[model samples]
Target: MLDESLLDDPEALARADRRELLRGAAEAGARVRTAVRHATEAGIAELKPDGRPRAVLIAGPGLAATGVAELLGTLAGASCPTTRLTPTGVAPASGALRWELPGWAGPVDLLLIATPDGSEPGLELLVEQAYRRGCSVVAVAPAGTPIVESVQGTHGLFVPMATAPYEPTEPLAASAPGVLWALLTPLLVLLDRTGLVSAPPEALEKVADRLDSVAERCGPAIAPYSNPAKTLAAELAEALPVIWTEGTSAGPAGRRFTAALAELAGRPALTAELPEALAAHSVLLAGALAAGADPDDFFRDRVEEAQALHARVVLLRDRPAGGLTAAPAARELALSHDTAISELEPEEGGELETLAELIAVTDFAAVYLALASRA
Candidate 1:
């Protein structure tokens, strides 16, 4: 059970944030600036790429890497193809996971790597393979890791993953909040120069500014009634959230929310894109997870057990495709099944800024859930 009172108590929330999760969420904007600076120092901005690579191959070990690859792939769309190289194996080390380049990968391909942990031997070896294939490579990871040496030796560009003033000791905690920007910003800078994306430094500054504004609104000091993040945490305390995203930008943000819920809040969530989501998640809304499924649920002894979980539809909306929106139908479907809905519609902005806002608010909500929930 969650202590609702804790959501309004700034000091209590801080005390519960032993891993400094809240701090990390608040520092997202700062991390973006730091990352941009790192890219400049690493000469990412000065790259005079002969041209965009034939295809982009990205590889990494965990959630952060996959999220980066997905976001980059979405942004790169038709201009350049971005593929996440999944780990496969025959030549395996102690039966550990491995990554191998596809047969078609060659000199014309570009390999991008992003990881919060730079010590992965698999990733280091992947760099070697990319070098041997004559693929141009670029990576961002913590400074002084073995992967840095491997990347440098392979003649790949290495940008250090920016860190906060108080880096968390736990790896998952480290990856949850601010580190994503650190991993992503430098890559955005590089991609902008290569003409695959539109994230110039000024546009990136707008993203940072947008993030800071969200932090202010969603900060611990705010009360639940006025705070979107705290309100979301309270709503999700006993909910099995069925996150439905209605825009291209919302898709990545919705997926990120589920991952953050699991990683930071120790909660599992389900997400699907709009029209497909209506059919994919309809069963959940109509089944035992539905609000009206149990008439006697409310009369059950509150002292004996925690509240029963119910499906809650979290609608994340951004710009629509071809000016068409599926949100009205989604809301109607949820209402027809007697399910509660939580909607997050972004303010008007460029694609990167809007994406940053969706991510920031959801990130704060996850931190609130992490801090205020009882074990």
Candidate 2:
């Protein structure tokens, strides 16, 4: 148990430390809100178009392309046709205005380039092509670039890498996508609201405000449990393997297994890179096979590498087939009954029975509950 004295210490220094940290976080949140509002207003103001230009979204590979392209299209509306452009192809055709790159023969309007930091050659060529075509260029790069200043001064928008209005980082945090969307979605809505496209400010504000409110409410709830950030961190401490796969359905059964583990462990658990502290213990591979991951190699090759180690491999496949399978060399394998652990799955009406069973079968240490919900 955590020491109550540490939480309720009478020491003047401890009180001051707590106060400062909370105050700092509050102040930072307020500053971010204010800056976001100002940026939104400026983007709206500049969006007044005499003639609509073809809007091209030049994106790198992966989820970044799909996410950002859809967002740009929504913001552009009918005023500008938004298309995705890659390194090898011309921008898509969707309107009267033709957005040409270096090799294409057409007029240009606006080019939004999404690339990571230190990717110089591709970014430079894209920007040069846009400049030659006399199109307004917007570059989204990771933070800490001196070139952003030049872009800003020349009537171009340089959204820093950290605030690129897109989810770019890997092992994506549960809170990150919402935060980015909350900040960028409003600015895009504002553009349409201000008659840059064809929407009213009142309508757009209502939508943006609702999005902001949802994010503010659900962000913290999901931060501790559903977040890949927290999960990764906890898994690292246990020297466990963390595998991330896409869900075929809306339910989250795999996450529930991790959450249950966290409750039994009595701490905020996470999945992350293997930690050095776990070197002493014989690391065990324990996870539900329903997570759609193959456990055979994960246990044999990865876990067996430790020179002095023992492992109990438990595979929880879906029921009626709850029996032991052939085991690998030196591995104790077991099979368990499957219970639908997804949030969408109806409760079994046996909460007490389940809890009691869990306690009896596993060693109890500490338990913590982390809740996560999407906005």
Best by TM-score: 1
What does candidate 2's lDDT look like per residue over 83-168, in tens digits? 67644434322111132363551355566655433244445555655666666766655455544554565566765433423233
lDDT values of the candidates?
Answer: 0.89, 0.34
- Which pairs of residues clash in candidate 1, taking residues 3 or more apart in a chain or in different chains? none
Model 2: ten consecutive residues of lowest lDDT: 366-375
Which candidate comes out best when scored by lDDT? 1
- The positional error of residue 162 in candidate 1, measured at the CA in angstroms, is 0.8
Q: State the displacement of the C-alpha of residue 150, model 1, in Å, after optimal TM-score superposition.
A: 0.8
Q: Per-residue lDDT tens digits of candidate 1, residues 139-258? A: 999999988999999899999998877656554553488878989999999999999999999999999999999999999999899999999999999899899998878999999999
What are the candidates' C-alpha RMSDs?
2.1, 14.8
Query: Which ranges in model 1 have alpha carbons more than 4 Å from their true place?
Result: 88-95, 172-175
